[model samples]
Target: MLQSFMNVFTTLGDTVVVPIVIFIVALCLRVKARTALMSGLLVGVGLTGFGWIINAFTPVVTKIVRQMVSTTGINLPVVDTGWQTSALVSFHSTVGITFFIVGLILEIVLFLIGYTKVFFATNLWMNWGFMIWGTLAYFVTKNFWLSLGLSIFMMLYVLLTAEVQADRYSSYYKINNGTVGAAHNMENVVPAIILDPLWNLLHFDRVHLTPDALKEKLGILGEPTFIGGVLGIIIGILGNIRRLGTLDAWGQILGFGVKLAAVMTIFPLVAHLFGQAFKPLTDEITERYSKGDTKGLSEEENIKSKKRWFLAVDDGLGYGEPATIISGTILIPIVILLAFILPGNKTLPVVDLVSIPFMVESIIAVTHGNILKTIANAIVWFSLGLYMCSYIAPIYTHAVAQYGVALPAGAVLIASFNVMCRPLNGLIFLAWISGNPLWIGLTIIVYAAFQVFLRTRRQQIWMYLKKMSDRNIAPTSNSNMASEIKKQMIKS
Candidate 1:
């Protein structure tokens, strides 16, 4: 009965279900019923529109990656089953159906104890990411408690990171109450901690290739539209270089370029509509609870405001930003090339390659849209994941194969870069299944220490992000909204 219900829930997908949840949350927050209803519909529309833009280009990009691989005569053993396979395998398990409940309880408990300021009960579907590791851990040990513990730990890790990074996301992406809560996105805090100092020491933080920065220096030529078109042309050339002399090839190239250009132009407008969807609920929460001049808060309201709670929403909110798009798209071909050249990497990174934009939003947001740093961070992360996905492909294959999923012809094993999620997650899983008490203890200690750092050093983390991010400039496209954001960011 639980499995049957789970199937129906997963089948409904995000666009259909998330908006309904949003509406209910809005009403619970005491927002107007009419406004809540409209907000819900707008969110659904925005998600659908994002789906349309992504779906339109995905097949094309996937084909290009496959073609590039074929032309280069590269062979990788593990098939890239993408996140659909990963999520389905995850949700099919005993661990999956209950992870949402566990994660929510944990989130609420942490918030109540003042250990985390992130309220992530919204967008619970994203919690499926935890079960990827949970599913894999279960397959290895067949131990339910251990599997559940891994999932809970992954959730706890992200909740803490999300709280620490909330100020940066709001200040940089101008999403107000929204902070990236996607496990794939928040897990990036791992790399940022390890390598961010290197980026600073090398002075990579000084160069800004974000769209707004470009516009300031080069005028209209630096506009996102122009940048998108140029990036499209580069991708076109990469995909069609061998056929450059043919007329049809030029047509395909230019047409592909124009398609990307269209996505670049249309995505922000779509994103703005999505952000507007949350305005009513966010405004109500802020006005009702904020201890600031907006309202004289009761004790409860003051505690709520002082906690500085942020909504852990989808990364899709910032996925449309120019730097986010560019950083992910540019890595498409590089992913293929690296797959061939990187030692011990057996996964070809097919379907997930097209979904790179979703994976990089948090990194881009934290860097304040520093395209160079974002790409640099992504390349390192993806390279490591290639090895991780390859190492775990057999177990992942075994985990999902029980479902009797239709395999692409001649495929034996499969994995997803996203299932690797991040190096820290991969390391945690490795230690758990290693059967080494020392490794397990070390992993626990490291994770516990990191969580403590996020909890205690949040202000220091925010200061570092502020130093890395641009200031005294518009964070959002709307000048008035940007001014308000600037004021809030300053006061904070």
Candidate 2:
């Protein structure tokens, strides 16, 4: 019965459900009915636009990838059946059942206590991200409690980490006040953040490969619309290169390019609709917080009262930027090459390659869409991720079989790029299943430390990032200045 209800719930999907949820939440916040209605409708329409955009691009991109794969003729032990199938499998699992029901309850409790401030509706259905790791943990431990506990911890962990980066993401993409609450957590981002300075050290940041950066060098040619068209044409030509002598090859190439260009051009417009959906809430929240006169309050007291809550939101809103589109699309082929060349990799890069953009959205958030750094960071990630996915293949296959799901004919095993490459989640799950007191204790310490930093330093973090924004620079992940300020912030 739970699964039946879930199925119906999912079928209604974000477009239908988000608006209603948003309306209800807006009403609860005392939003005018007309404004609430507009917010909800805008959200629904915006999401529908995102769906259309994704649907339009995916098939063409997949077709291009299929050609590339056929040409390469590389085979591997695990087939990438894509994320939707994996999400479906997880949603049907015991872990999914517990997370959807229990997770919702936990979120409400956390919000009421001021432990968290995200409106659950903004990230609707994303809570299923908790189930992916939970299901994987269940595969190793056979204990539902362990799975549920870890899943809950991961949710809290991701939220805390996401809170730090959320404002930067929103500011960079011009999305309304929301943080990424997607499933592919930010584990890999730690290394990327650690290594980011090298690019600056090498003066590669001067090239500023992001579209915004390019405008400095090339003017109108660097505009996102133009860059999108050029990228589309390049991809079209490369994807169909082998068919050069074929009758309709040129037609196919130009058609794909034009379509891609159109999609890219349309994204920011759709994103505007998306932003409009939540702007009313953001405005209200900002106004409410600024009220109740700051007459005699201390600086700290005033700052605390004026603090803003960033809702957890979808990755789709981040897709509008040209850098995000370019870097993610480009990663598909990079993942393919890494699959073929990376030593000991047993997972074939296939369907999920198309999802490389969404997969790397978090990276884009941190890297601020700097193409060179983003691509370099992602290459390292995929290099390690391929092997990790390969390692998880057997358990994934068993989970599918155990659930009476059939594999594709002639497929030996399966892994999803989006599923198994979560480095931190994988570490935590391994520690739990290892049953070593030391490992479990260390994991606890890690979460506790991050929790302390995130919860305690929210204001400092916000102020620091805001200052960076005021300086007209993308927020550095962890600069020397930032580290020093944080040190002082903790003491204060």
The most accurate candidate by TM-score is 1
Off by over 4 Å in 2: 290-306, 463-492
Instruction: Report the Cα lDDT for residue 88, model 2.
Output: 79
Sequence-dependent TM-score of model 2: 0.88
Q: What are the lDDT scores of the predictions, listed in order?
A: 0.76, 0.73
Best by lDDT: 1
lDDT by residue (1-492, candidate 1, tens digit) is 657867777789889788888888778777789988998898899889988988888887776666666766667889896888878777888887677667766776776677777777767778888877887888899888888888888887777777766877776677666777778887776676567778877777766667777887788878777777787777777777787899977787787788888887899899888888877767667766664543555423332345466776667777778878878878888887888899887887888887788888777767778777887887888888888888888888888887776678767778787667467788888888776789988977877897878666766666666665553234445766779899999999
Output the lDDT of residue 92, model 1: 80
Clashes of each: 0, 0
Candidate 1, residue 322: Cα displacement in angstroms equals: 0.7
